[model samples]
Target: MRRLQSPRRTYDWGSREEIPDFLGQPVDGERVAEVWLGTHALAPSLVDGPDGPRSLLEVSGELPFMLKILAADRPLSLQVHPDAELARAGFDAEEASGTPLDAPHRVFKDPHPKPEMVLALTTFDTLVGFRPTAEILRVLGALPTSLTQKLAERLRAEPGFAGIVALVEQLVTDPPTPQEVGDVVAACADGVQRRTDVKRAYLTALEVNEHHAGDVGVVISLLLNRLTLQPGEAAYLATGIIHAHLKGMCLEVMVSSDNVLRAGLTSKHLDPQGLVRCVSGGMSRLARVEPEQFGESTDVFSPGLREFALSMTQVSPAEPAGTPLPDQGRRIIVCTGGEVELVNEHDERLPLRRGSAVYADAADGTIRAHGTGEVGQAYTPTAEDRATPLTDLV
Candidate 1:
C-alpha cells in the first residue's frame, strides 16, 4: 500500500471548518469543499516515491473510479449528468466546436457517465430526483399565485409523470419572468409559514431563492424530493437525475468523470436546453442504499455501479487485527476516524490517520486493518467489466 497525498477543492459553497476539523488541521478560514483521492486528471492525488512526490497518474495511471470527502455548507448547483452515449456525443460535439477543455462555459469535461453514490458522514440534506406528481401538485396548489394556480391546473388535468416532465421542461426552457419568479418565491415563503403539509417544499424554495433570488430553479426545487440522511445512510444518483447537495459531509464515490449539465441555483454556466435534454422528466424513485454487513463492523455499500463500490470498516482497539479488505483490483482507502495501520500479506505496512489516504494496487494481496477507527475503501468489484481497466491508460 502506497501512502497518498490527496488534494482538497475549495469552492464558495464549502464549509470553512468542517474539512479542516475532520482532518485535525488548524482552521485556516478557507472553504474546503472536497478532498479528491483518485487519479482523475483534474485533481489527481499525489504519491511519494523514489523520485520524490509524483502524481498518482504516474504511479497507477487512471483509476476507473474516484472517491471524495465532500462537505457542503450551502447548496450545490441543480444539475444532472448525461448517460455514456450522450456524454460521448456532447464531448465530441463540444470538441469539434473549438471549445477549450478549461473554458468556464464548457459543459462536458470527459466522455464518461458519472453515476454516483453519497454516504452521509453527518446529517446530509439533499434535493434529489422528482417528487411524486401528486405531492408537487399539492405544493403548487398551496401557493397563492396565478402562475402556480395555472401550473396546478395543468398538472391536475394530466396528472402523471408525463405532466411532471412537461411542466419541468416548460418552466426550464421557457422560464417565467423575474417578477413572476419573485412572486412565486413570495407565495412559497407564505405557504411555508402557513402550511405544514407543504412545509419542506416551501422551505426548500425559500432556501434556493435566498441563494439565487428570482431564479427559476427556486420553482424547480419544489418539484424534487427533499431527503435528510443520517450518518451511514446513503443515496445513489443515476445518470439523467437532477440533484443538489444542500448541506453536511459525505463520502461520495463515482465513475471518474466531471460532466455536469446545470440548470440553476449556481453562479456557474447555465445550460437550460442541455440540462433539459439530459435530465429525465419522469418521477424518480428514491435510491436509498442499505448497507450489507460482512463480518463485524464492516459494511459494504455496493449500489451496483459498474465502476466503483465502497466499504466502511470500523476497527476497535479490542480487535487489534481488524477486518480483511478486498485484495483484488485497485483500491483507495481513506481513514475517516482515528489512526490505522494498513498491513499487506507480505508484512508491508502503511500507516494512515484521519484524512490520510492510501492507494493499494491489485498485486497487494490480502490486506488487513490494524488499529482503532473507521476507514472507507473504494474498489472495483470482481463482477465488474474488467475488459477496460482504467489502469491500462497512461
Candidate 2:
C-alpha cells in the first residue's frame, strides 16, 4: 500500500467550508468543489509516498475508475452524460473538427461513457431525472402563472416522454424571457404561500431562483424530480439521466471520463442539442442504490458496473482484529474520519487519517483495517486488468 496525494478542484457552485473542513486542511476561502483521487488524465492523482510527488500515471498506469469527494454549495448545472454510443460519436466529431482537448468549447473530453453514483455523506439534495408528465404538469399548474401555464400547454401539446423532450429542447434552445422567468418564480412563491400539494416543487424552484434568478433552469426545475438523500443513502446515476446536485456533500464514483453535456445553471459552454441527444434515452426516475452489506461493518456499493465499486469498512476499537478488505485489483483507499491503518499480508502498514488516501495493489493481498475510522475503497472485481505488482515500498 502506498500513500497518494489527491487534487482539489474549485468551482463557483462549490462549498467554501465543507471540503476543506473535512480534509483537515486550512481554508483558503475558495469554493472547493471536488477532490479527485484517481488517474483520469485531466486531474490525475500524485504518488506522495516515500519516493516522491510524481504523477500516479507514471507509477501505476491508467486506472479505469475515478473517485471524487463532491461538495456542492448550490445547484449545479442541469447536465447529462452520454452513453457509450453518443460518447464515441461526439468524441470523434470533436476530434475531426480539430477541437483541442483542453478547448473551452470542447464537449467530450474522452471517448468513455460516464456512469456515476453518488453516496450521500450529508443531507444531499439533487434534481434527478424528469418526473412523470402528469406530475410535472401538476407542479407547473400549481404555480399558475402565464409563463408556467404556457409551459404546461407546451408540455400538454404532446404529453409523455416525447412532449418532455420537445419542451426541454425549447427551454434550452429558445428559453423564456427574463420577465417570464420572474413570473414563474413569483407564481411559485404564491404557490408556496397557498400550501399546494406540490409545495416541495415550488420551494425547490424558489431555491434555485435564489442563486440563478431569471435563469431558464429555475423554471425548468419544475420538470425534474426533487430528491433529498440522507446520510449513508446513495443514488446511482446512469448515462443519459439528467441531474443537478443541489447541495451538501457526497462520495461520487464514476467511469474514468470527463465528458459532460450541459443545458443550464453554469457559466461553462452550454450544449443544448448535445444534452438533448444524451437524454434521448428518456429516463424519468432516480436509480436509488442499495449497498451490499458485508458482515456487520462493511458496506460495498457495487452498481453492477464492470468499472468500479465502492467498499466502505468501518474500523473501531471493538474489533481490534480489523475488518478484512477484499482483494479487488487496483484500489484507492480514503479515510473519511478518525485515524486508521491498513495492514497487508506482509504486515506492512499504511497509515491514514481524515482526508488522507492511499493506493494499494492487488499484490498486497487481503489487507486488514486497524484503528477507528471509515475507510472508503474504490475498486472493482476485474482479474483481467489488474495493474502489475508494485515492488517499491516504504
Candidate 3:
C-alpha cells in the first residue's frame, strides 16, 4: 500500500471551503471543485514510493476506473456522457478530423464511457433524467408562455420519452430568444413568490436563472427530475442520462474518462448536436442507490457496473477494529472522517486521517484498517459477473 497525494481541481462552480475543510487544510479562498484520486492523464494522483513520489500511472498502468471527491457549491452543466460504443466512435472521429486534444471544443478526452455514481456526504441536490409526462405538463401549464406552451404541446402530442427528447432538442438546437428566456424566468419567479406550495420545477428554474441568467438550461430544468439525497444516500447515472448536479459534496466514481456532451448551464463549450445524439430516448426516475450493509457500519454501493464499486465503512470508538480491505483488484481507500491506520499482511502500516487517501496494489494481499473513522474504498469489480443493462439499473 502506498500513500497518495491527490490532485485538487478548482472550478468556477466549486465550493470555496468545503474541500479544504474536508481535507483538514486551511481554506485558500479558491473554489476547490474536485480532488482526483486516480491515474488519468489530465490530473494523475502521485503515489509515495520508495524512490520518492511518482505518478500513479507509473506504478499501476492506466486504471480502468477513477475516483473523485466532488464538491459542487453551484450547479454543474446540463450534460450527458456517451456509452462505450459512442465514446469510441466519437473519439476516433475527432482524432480523424485532426481536432487537437487540448482544443476547447474537443468533446472526447478518452475512448472510454463514463458511468458515474455520487454518494452524498451531505444533503445533495441534483437534476436527472426526464420528469414524467403529466408532471411536465403541469409545470408547463403553470408557466403558460409561448415557449413552454409549444414544448407542452409537442410533449402532449408524443407523450413519452420521444417527446422529452424532442423538447430538449428544440430548446438546444434552436434556443429561445433572450426575451423568451427572460419571460420564462419572470414567470417562474412570479410563481415562486405567489404559490404557497411552490413547485420544485419553478424553484429550480428560478435558482438556475440566478446563476446562468438567460441560459436555456433555466427552462430545461423543468423537464428533468429534481432529487435531494441525504447523507449516505447515493445516485447512479449511466451513460446517456442527462444530469446536472446542483449542490453539496459527494464521492464520485466512474470509468476513467472525461468526455462530456454539454448543452447548457456552463461557460464551457456547448455541443447541441452531440448532446442530442448522446441522450437516451427513454425516461427514467431518480436512480437512487441502495447500499447493502454488512456487519455493522460497512455499506457497499454496487451499481452493477463491472468497472467500479464503492464501499464505505464507519468505525466507532467502542469498536476499534478496522474492516478488511478487498484483496483482489487494485483499490483506493479514502478516509472521509477521523483517523485510521491501514495495516497490510506483512504488518506494515500507513497512518491515515480525514481526507487521506492511499493506493493498494493487488499484490498487497489482505489489508485491514485500525482506529475510529469512516473510509470509502473504490475498486474494480470482477469480470466474471455478467454486465447489467444500464436501463434496468436505472
Best by lDDT: 3
Clashes of each: 0, 0, 0
lDDT of 2 by residue, 1-394 (tens): 7788888999999999999998998988999999999898789999875656988888778888899999999999989999999999989999999999989899999999999988888999998888888888898877668877887998888898888888888899998888999988888888888788483888998999998988889988888888888987777788988888999999999999989999889988999999988885553646776666666798777777888878778898887688887654688888988999889989998888988988888688888889988888888744422321212110
* Reference-based TM-score, model 2: 0.94
Local distance difference test values of all predictions, in order: 0.84, 0.84, 0.86
Which regions of candidate 2 deviate over 4 angstroms?
Answer: 197-199, 382-394
Cα displacement (angstroms), candidate 1, residue 88, comes to: 0.6
Question: TM-score of every model?
Answer: 0.93, 0.94, 0.95
Worst 10 residues of 3 by lDDT: 385-394
| Cα lDDT tens digits for candidate 1, 1-394 | 7888888898888999999988888999999999998988778899888878899988788999999999999899989989999999999999999999889999998889988989999999999888787788889888888888988999999877778777878888888887998999888767766665473998888887887888888888988889999998787888988888899999999999889998888888989888878876457855777677657778777777668888888877766665687546689999999988888878898888898889988678778898888899998865532222211100
Off by over 4 Å in 1: 384-394
RMSD of 2: 5.9
Q: Answer with 2 or 3, whichever has the higher lDDT.
A: 3
Rank all candidate structures by their lDDT, best first, as comma-separated numbers.
Answer: 3, 2, 1
